[model samples]
Target chain A: ATERPEALLLVMPTDHAIPDVDAFRAAVAAGVPRAVAGQIVTFGVRPDRPETGYGWIEVRGAPVDGVAQRVERFVEKPELARAEAMLAEGRYLWNAGIFLVSAKTLVAAVTAHAPDLIEPVGEAVAEARGDLDFLRLSEGPWSGVRDISIDFAVMEKAANIEVIPLGTAWSDLGDWNAVWRENGGGIVTQGAVTAIDCEGSLLRSEVGGQHVVGIGLQDLVVVAMPDAVLVADRARSQDVKTAVAQLKAKAVRQAEVFPRDHRPWGWFETLALADRFQVKRIVVKPGAALSLQSHVHRAEHWIVVSGTAQVTVGEDVKLLTENQSVYVPLGAVHRLANPGKVPVVLIEVQTGAYLGEDDIIRYEDIYARGDEQGPKR
Target chain B: ATERPEALLLVMPTDHAIPDVDAFRAAVAAGVPRAVAGQIVTFGVRPDRPETGYGWIEVRGAPVDGVAQRVERFVEKPELARAEAMLAEGRYLWNAGIFLVSAKTLVAAVTAHAPDLIEPVGEAVAEARGDLDFLRLSEGPWSGVRDISIDFAVMEKAANIEVIPLGTAWSDLGDWNAVWRENGGGIVTQGAVTAIDCEGSLLRSEVGGQHVVGIGLQDLVVVAMPDAVLVADRARSQDVKTAVAQLKAKAVRQAEVFPRDHRPWGWFETLALADRFQVKRIVVKPGAALSLQSHVHRAEHWIVVSGTAQVTVGEDVKLLTENQSVYVPLGAVHRLANPGKVPVVLIEVQTGAYLGEDDIIRYEDIYARGDEQGPKR
Candidate 1:
């Protein structure tokens, strides 16, 4: 279906940031000839510190082809003493999780080492369906495939795996500490953050009109979101998921969902929520139409603030430009659409005794979300 | 004025908190007889620590009447070693800032020691006027009185003075550290606050519906208000005034004012502010009426959420119950009042090109604020 290359294909995680792209390209190029000769190539970074957080790759002998060394084994994350001992020796390298191999070579190695995964994955891919522009894999076959990483299934068992040394500025931003290291290891701040006498800290505010301040803080991480805030030690940044899990156990909506809801058309955010009334700021993308819907418990008033909106209420249809407004009475079927070439922004004030989002009954939906009642746009 | 006591009058700063009221009363009672016998009395507490924040009172002679000692001198706040040495001497006590003296004795002492203050203070009191329930001092003579403490103007030069020891648990609460101590010396939190692995910190959130989380924090002070937030080291809590002064220099409104505006009737807070529209939640106490006013550049929509509202729009007057609404067009005279026995709560949505609070022209007001142009109720 596409221009398939014969020499090598490189795979790298999107999270790793390599500052020297030219040096990385040279390292990948050095492994291309060896990979084309049926040797599975994995890049390894020379250990600069005794970092126990990373896995290690041990090289057995000198480079067989002057650039790639024969990998002896891939070791799991080790203790401090073990990592220090490996760092004292010159043969250990941090596993960079980068692979360079031909398509045929990967298929052959998976067939030999992880024979159970290839058939189900291939069947799922062959039966994948296209939705708009995204390809969704078949659920049944994909769920049947074993969940395992390439290191556990292929690289650990393959006999001809080679290691290429990568000597460039790189970092895997796995936690707030790593992010601080990537950002020069002093004080990193963003968005309405004020710091005084702070050292080695990260303070971030993602809320629109809120502020975060830190004073005399050392080795701390403070993150402020709109609905929730997080403060943790730099060493405990990996335990942020525990806080999220705690919130989930309490059924806190802010744990997983943001105040702003993004959809295919555009986005909408709640401005205020009251007992019997609610306010929202909604933006509709150009040529996007909401579903024809009716609510038995609520009535809505929409005021256009930006582009024009095509509004249909009951039997009447009208175009509302900036500064114009329309009202939908309870039990009235209505549809809102943006027919212009720009986004339409409006403020919606809904009033009712029961104003939950599940009160809506959709008759037609363009984004195929009529049956799914999780959130309303 | 009706029941003047012949015994001593006790004066203490309102900010100081003494936990053992019984012991304090007993100490005051001990000084009453001495004070009635024509000696001015001052209380002193034995130093529990080498506290440099308070002035020291040095005693010279033993108890004259078995409970009070003759006073010697008052020393300014001392350096560390001086305070420690004074503590070790056992003759110096921390000034408790309490004074007790008979009215006639105080008059005689002031006449002899601070002759200049007696005349103007007497004239100001003689010419004071009664306004409603308050006695207002005459401005001219009151302003002429010198700004000097009683210790400097009278007590230092008085011949018959006595010092009494009073042992009790007390706190000045001069700064956040003192407040922390008053709260029992560990993490003290109020409102919606969550803490993890925090020690000796104070985290407070005064705003409703806002969460303040502190993790791995030690000796930190964090205060969150609706419109502003403050974070500072516990050691530098006394320097928080500098931050407020800096904000004042920048003309930040949050430095001196809160988001909620308190009125004589009740209070109101802004819910949302936009380019040409603003929303406010207003509460009115029973039997409270707003001014008859009109806006030049805005219109308002009032929706009653609780109780009843007596609304006057232009020439029409009506009583709106819960869930009822009314609209006031621009330049239309209007007034809102709570006529029921219960409080009234309403949401006001104002739409205009210029939505400043100063756009109102008041014709009549029951609160006698027609001539004053300030925040409107």
Candidate 2:
């Protein structure tokens, strides 16, 4: 917390911002001592354009030695000429998503300007809970506050906000173009990508997925996420939020999320699709068991491909190994357990007229999934 | 072939010389009556430019009754201004790939001027060997013949080389740009592409093999092949032959061909890589088996993920079902057979200090891979 006559690093993080860990570390190592002199240290990013996409900072007057003059005022992205002027004069920064401060000075400064943030943040820190190396802020206070960025509530009103021009490469990774810029362009392919005439774009496919191909495209973003695919122009990538909003508005099952949700127990994914039938690849961790339940509308066929599967079907219990299979009729009380010490992988083919999450009638659940179950998270 | 009115077709391939198929077809279709009565038929193409890329025909004298013209002389693509003057004069026609003529008239003209081609072509056809669906021409006398296009070898020398300009949309498909134009400019990825200052461009990506992402590029042709990738300027695409020659010179595996070699059985692909180890996903068709072989430097591990695998390790044999595994030590002869009526899918992990195709020693074979040891086509 002590300033050591090094530079003060200012980091401002936007919501959903994931700052480059390496750059933040580099900035800290470069500016620790200069911060002791009460000189300002802030990171300045080159504006991507006269971007209505970001908040703009205008540095007024000349530099006081190495420290920049006080910021005149914060302004949102301006008209075209002003943006061009900003690019020409080159003093303004794009308000990089991060900032670092001299512990003593920033606390003093924030207390003077925005007392509400400082007190709650201080209390939260004092009473902060730690679990698994993560600092969990008390949700009651952290989420209760008005949704406002530090730029709006604090930085704009500060008087001695000096600028540190970031000539080093930086990217917000706010969208696909940023991702493309991060990845050196040309021949960008993930999972067997075939592309032609694509420029300044990111084409990605997740693991265990089909190959993706892009042809004669330039400056576009193609993402193959589980359950949903996203194809958008790089310039219009910010509108993905609108896509997500539309998905929510439409109540689309695919857009809501992937059907095979990942958990600590291992994940399950569906492979076969039909109106009356579905097949799933089921994997369970060692000694894990599924809930004791039955599908009201569906019957299931289980093929034990590997490991040992202990099945309780109605009045009978049996252990199945590789090359063995079983069938569970609808409404029959059934539970699958991996009684062995090895991961169990199996295929379950389900037949039903209606296959939806709501059809699952859980009788008892060890993983806390039913109504009587506790919140698992 | 019978004579038909008002429907003349010509198939003029873009090559040095051959009798046009459409011309022959048109000749057959037009019969002797209509052609002699002056209902002329012909094929015409628009010139790209004063392109040395094609052969140009010039018409002299005036149009005779708006039906026929005296083809004074055939001038190949000339200097730019002269070609422009030819176009301006509006009395020239770029030879359409096809020419239509009445059978009687064409046979008579060929007999008068190109009698040599007629005899050999006639013998070649009479003695043509039947191979599958195609008529294979024997090389004996056919190869001895002079290589000349029917247009130059016959039409130019004929007394009645009528010119009827049929302005149907046509393309030679002689270049990448022409193919792209025919398929639509944005055929690869459509309007998803945005070119900024790029010109004279041809970009194409094969599905599931390559994806091109471009930035700050111009006049470039980028083709994504299955195994190898190509990036060349449009002007230099013609020089791709040079690149292929270099690759052949260097004996690079990808330069000459692709990695996915088709076979009688199912295919195999590399899945994992390490300096001393390489893993492959091998799929065997039902009733298919690998050759009995041994590797001096490499050992292999096979884990059956699907279907039944019949494994022969030295003198012993075993049937391994899904989720079962096996290990083959170095210098130990082993062969895998898929005797079940289902495809066998397995993950094979191989480890060796030096792993190359040349390391395998085959003893007994099933698919004739060891016979004569020809290149895997």
Compared to the true structure, candidate 1 yields what TM-score? 0.73
Please, what is the TM-score per model?
A: 0.73, 0.49
TM-score of chain A of each: 0.80, 0.63
What's the distance in Å from true for residue B81, model 2? Answer: 7.5
DockQ of each: 0.26, 0.04
CA error at residue B270 for candidate 1, angstroms: 4.4
lDDT tens digits by residue: candidate 2, B205-249: 442312233334445554544344444445544455555565566
Error of 1 at A347 (Å): 4.4
Off by over 4 Å in 1: A1-49, A55-76, A80-168, A249-252, A270-280, A289-305, A309-336, A346-363, A373-377, B1-174, B205-211, B250-253, B270-280, B289-337, B346-377
The 10-residue segment of model 1 chain A with minimum total lDDT is: A1-10
Off by over 4 Å in 2: A1-61, A64-69, A74-98, A102-153, A164-377, B1-175, B186-236, B246-253, B264-266, B271-274, B279-289, B303-309, B319-325, B337-347, B366-377
Please give the C-alpha DockQ score of model 2: 0.04
Model 2 chain A TM-score equals 0.63
